[model samples]
Target: MNRVDLLTRSDALARPASIAVDDVSVTYPNGFTAVRDASFELGPGTICALVGVNGSGKSTIFKAIMGFVTPSAGQVRLCGLPVDKAVSQNIVAYVPQSEDVDWNFPVLVEDVVMMGRYGHMNLFRIPSRKDRRKVDEALERVNMSAYRTRQIGELSGGQKKRVFLARALAQEGRIILLDEPFTGIDVTTESAIIDLLRELRDAGHLILVSTHNLGSVPDFCDQVVLLNRTVLAAGPTATTFTQENLERTFGGVLRNFELSGHALHEDDDARSLNVITDDERPLVFYGVKKGKKKPARDKAK
Candidate 1:
């Protein structure tokens, strides 16, 4: 990757200066409320992580922001323009989750990434030299240049994701929203993607990514938005990803295994080893499990 071109790209995104969501809400045809009065703001050069359990409205928020689902109430704005209008101008890019994409479709890696530039180029015009150059640059950014000619079905889960991300980067949007970008990928690929996101943020694009991984938030995100059908919390990771708040959002049943140091409900014994300092008291909660008792720790000790 050319450092000069990357810097130039970043500077261009920074000049734009804004994107925000105002009082957005969504309800399905069956009147099921997926997101209720959701609102947040993201400025240029920052990466925001949106987190929540399954069915917590994270995906719904992304759909609403992208204008795929019309809001039952409120608005989603990008640089003071409606999402649809901003999208038409190629101001934003969206990378949907890998599971959501159909791999059975016949498409090559380069062909998929090149689709990103479709909005900027004429609808019926074949890709020009400049468009192909942009596609190559995007592939290099994601470290997938060599796989340009490869079929999508032949790639691994991580490689397929990189291809989609390359497509988004090729679009050259000022703002990018990725839904669960890290799912099912190896640590190395995940790290590479995170590095790219940081580079993008430093370059001045606003990035919002929804993920289930809480351990990554502190290191990878500038801001964290926790949601469970609503905004449970939204702010810095230190403030929002707290034990108290997490328990409340995820339900008390979903205990933090880090504190207990024992995997939750792993043994049939229903008994877990506890270690506490002299001044500390260890609290153990037991629930009924249908099975035999395992040997105590002393047997192995």
Candidate 2:
């Protein structure tokens, strides 16, 4: 067998890690298409970023992968098993977007985080001291231990995000799917969360995050999956961030920028203004219009 075929077969037969999404697609009951013929494979000990604009099927894909939304076509597998089956076994943890959660539910932060352990505890059994200790460790991982007793409603947006993350940590799953974890948070909180995710990845967990923030993907993710109702691109950031692919994915809204000598310049300016003309192709500039030409210097004759 060829090298590629051998690798594929080996991966298929290998022990499952956290989550694996096959050719999964989702359609609403009203016949509206959300995700179309999408497929991706994620292994343990890796961080993947799902990037796209609004209504680009990022969250829809997440829902299908998590078994929250049934797929109209194809199958979603978790750790080599079907998604529905995996959910019952608590093999996956989902941290949803904060906007979808109601802050007025009147639950303490610690209680909410401790809820993650419910899957492990018997339906009617009380949490043991070990479970409580797991909860404590989870809260500590997200740096939310001090606010454990505070009401969820009293916490700031960043703190609320951390509480949800702590819940995921408490679950102790090998795979985690997060939706917009950095939304509406301060940079400090965002950085802290990123660091925590890295630590989790190091511990052999598979992490998949859907985000609109492209700036952080390169630094934080080992792979990037770009979607727009379909799999526009999927691969390493360096390979998938090409101008041709981005333009096709983002259409006319795609803008490109380049940094040189601590200054950012647009592709249009770099070309029309005659700033630099070499064999190097300029980056595509999106959104911004070409600026007016500067006045010519007076002759010294």
Candidate 3:
């Protein structure tokens, strides 16, 4: 048999990109501003974690980048082209929050993985043999090949997450946007996913994942973008994940228990602590508790 050499398909990867958000802002019909004047650029081969509170526009920004939500003012560009243009070329893949999905939709693992390839297939064309091969490769990469025939709803939470990640892999997207990919996953699966993410970064892929797990940012991400309806801090993890920045982004200490050991004093320092109103409960009770005064003239009776 004549030996045939197989070449890796790096050309299918997305072009080198500097994902730029030029003062982008998103506003809803009700006049609620989700993101305002947010500007940041993420380059190739790096992973960034978007951290913020519930209503802090993390998902809004992701939607803007994916063209689902249009920015009221600025622009979002990938590799020097508009986001929609980049998406049309199949250079972007988004893994939505698992909670947003209806797991009981009755879809098979491989079938869901195939959805990623639909972007590349012509409207009337069926999935080609190459598409099947890509699907197999993606499932294997996430170690979910054994469950390819299983129902997505039957799998564990981590397995479900892996399935979506496999879909992104099958797309061969250059820019991967993961929304809370690690939420509610097992420790083992979280580690596996983090390892896979690192490998992707090493392979020159750009990844931005929205996560509330602040501890893992330093270990698995190259950059951190702290958001509170806008870009509060964006840069290297070490410099950006400081206590002060986190407090500023998250609105003071994340836990009320951190306020322990501080007695309420009438000093200016105590007044500063009062600014943290979002704490679950008061750290220390202030003022004297009023009680019924006993009869002063009881001896007269």
Say which candidate scores most in lDDT. 3
Q: Can you rank all candidates by lDDT, best first?
A: 3, 1, 2
Q: Which ten residues in a row have the lowest lDDT in candidate 1?
A: 292-301
lDDT of 3 at 77: 95
lDDT of 3 at 132: 92
lDDT of 3: 0.78
Question: Please, what are the lDDT tens digits per residue for candidate 3 over residues 1-301?
Answer: 1001011264344368458999999999999999999999999889999988788999998998899999999999987889889899887888978888899988999999999999989997489998898888888889999999998899999999999999998887878999988778887998899998888887777899997766566678898899999999999875676556767887643642222123545443432121122332122222222222111111110
* lDDT of every predicted structure (CA atoms): 0.75, 0.73, 0.78
TM-score of each: 0.82, 0.80, 0.82
**What tens-digit string does per-residue lDDT give for candidate 2 at 196-239?**
88877766678899986655666678887888899888887666
| Candidates 1 and 3, the one with greater lDDT | 3
Tens digit of lDDT per residue, candidate 1, span 1-301?
Answer: 5834844654554446356767888999999999998888778788898977789999898888788899898888886788898889787888988888788788999999999989878869589887898898899888998998888988998898889889988888878898888878887888889999898888778889998665566667988788888888887665665545656676743434322224645545444443211121122222322223221111111
- Measured over all alpha carbons after superposition, the RMSD of each candidate to the real structure, in angstroms, is 9.0, 10.4, 12.2
Q: What is the TM-score (0 to 1) of candidate 2?
A: 0.80
The C-alpha local distance difference test score for the whole of candidate 2 amounts to 0.73
Q: Between prediction 1 and prediction 2, which has the larger lDDT?
A: 1
Collision count for each candidate, in order: 1, 1, 0
Error of 2 at 14 (Å): 12
Give the poorly placed runs of model 1, Cα more than 4 Å off: 1-17, 258-301
What lDDT score is found at residue 19 in candidate 2?
57
